[model samples]
Target: MIEKINLNNILFLDIETVPEYKNYRGLDLETQQLWEQKTQYQRKDEVSAEDFYERAGIWAEFGKIITISVGYFINKADIRNFRVTSFWGEEKKILQDFTNLLNTHFNGAQHILCGHNAKEFDIPFIARRMIINEIALPDKLNLFGKKPWEVPHLDTLELWKFGDYKHFTSLKLLTKVLGIPSPKDDIDGSEVAHVYYVENDIDRIITYCEKDVIAVAQIFLKLRREDLLIEDEIIHV
Candidate 1:
């Protein structure tokens, strides 16, 4: 079935996010209380809300997307290439630019958005951030009333699950087992917030995000029993 889908019609994406505020003190008193209440179970009396605040970026309400990297395949006359690009800077601008990409090129029924564990994370995170920024949801991210089958999203993580809903796999681990190049050679998701706040190197994060996008594309190729992308075939645009 994977071979039946058109690679050109699919847009592969990955996003890097950080906590909305640098620290717990950055939040207003009322919002701080809300954060404590919201994460009570996750903290489980083991760590204070302030101590756990570094991970707040995992939640849509408490986080902002810093960068979104996307890659798509282009084949012309049997010459194959993949182009990758990123939208970075302010959160609102990032969301707006990514929204524009979706609305412009991949808005058709035949177009699909692919990501690793995106059905559970990336897809909804983008939608929530868009709404927070007062941007209209694009057709690809707007999944309000559509039936399950009507959604035009594809998840490489889900595909690897193979109906084992109880199973979970991290992108890094999946890539390792599948022999795809690792995307986390520099920093993992846990360090994204720190890199953005303390190190102040967003360019590093953008490179990491793009690598994840390329890894996803490569994983799809492997799943389809096709050749993986060569270094020369990946273009950073």
Candidate 2:
């Protein structure tokens, strides 16, 4: 049986993104259409690169990452500490600050970065933006260079795939299945861009990110209890 991973070594993270430029909505629409077409023809079951690009563009323009929320459960402690750091002014500075904080706080540690759909979206998106800004990625973020199973990463979506892979298993859905309460009553993934752009409310974005972090932490707790359990009855009796 797999041993229960110590939650203290894991960092649950979530980011809020915005578009890079104004008037990019039309471009995003066209890209989405092309992505759908390509996916319908090529992968058939996967989202196309164009779709990814469109979402990225929306995030770059309308989705400005106003906040990055991080959560970690302290070992042998009942309290869980979290921080929601805001990135307001320049995108480059924001990314640099986030990266610097990661390096300063979590460098050289054997950390398992956890998030929802992080393997397919969050991690790649953050890495690409960091590269664009010429920021050096921390050692733990270098998952592309590592072997698939060897990567120190945990995506809750992948864990959910053990039972169902075809359906849309959002964080909300997974939390429900695991008997974890949903903390997303304020905002959601769809309204994130709108809040960042139309409302210009960075706090809303940060709140959404905080909810996501909690969801991730809850998912980690469930995974540890269910997938990493060792029954003494089977071994001793």
Question: Which model scores highest in lDDT?
Answer: 1
Error of 1 at 224 (Å): 0.3
> Which portions of model 1 show Cα errors greater than 4 Å?
none
Write the residue-wise lDDT of candidate 2 on 37-140 in tens digits: 54464443576544444344333322345566776654445444443344455777877876776787666556678888887777777777777777788777
Give the TM-score of each candidate.
0.98, 0.73
The global C-alpha lDDT for each of the candidates, from Candidate 1 onward, is: 0.94, 0.64
TM-score, cand. 2: 0.73
- Residue range 1-237, candidate 1, lDDT tens digits: 889998999999999999999998999998889999999999967799999899999999999999999999998888999999999999999898888998899899899999999999998999998888999999888888999999999999999999999899999999999999899999999999999999999999999999999999999999999999999999999
Q: Which 10 successive residues of model 1 have the least lDDT summed?
A: 37-46
Report how far residue 76 has shifted in candidate 2, in Å: 3.8
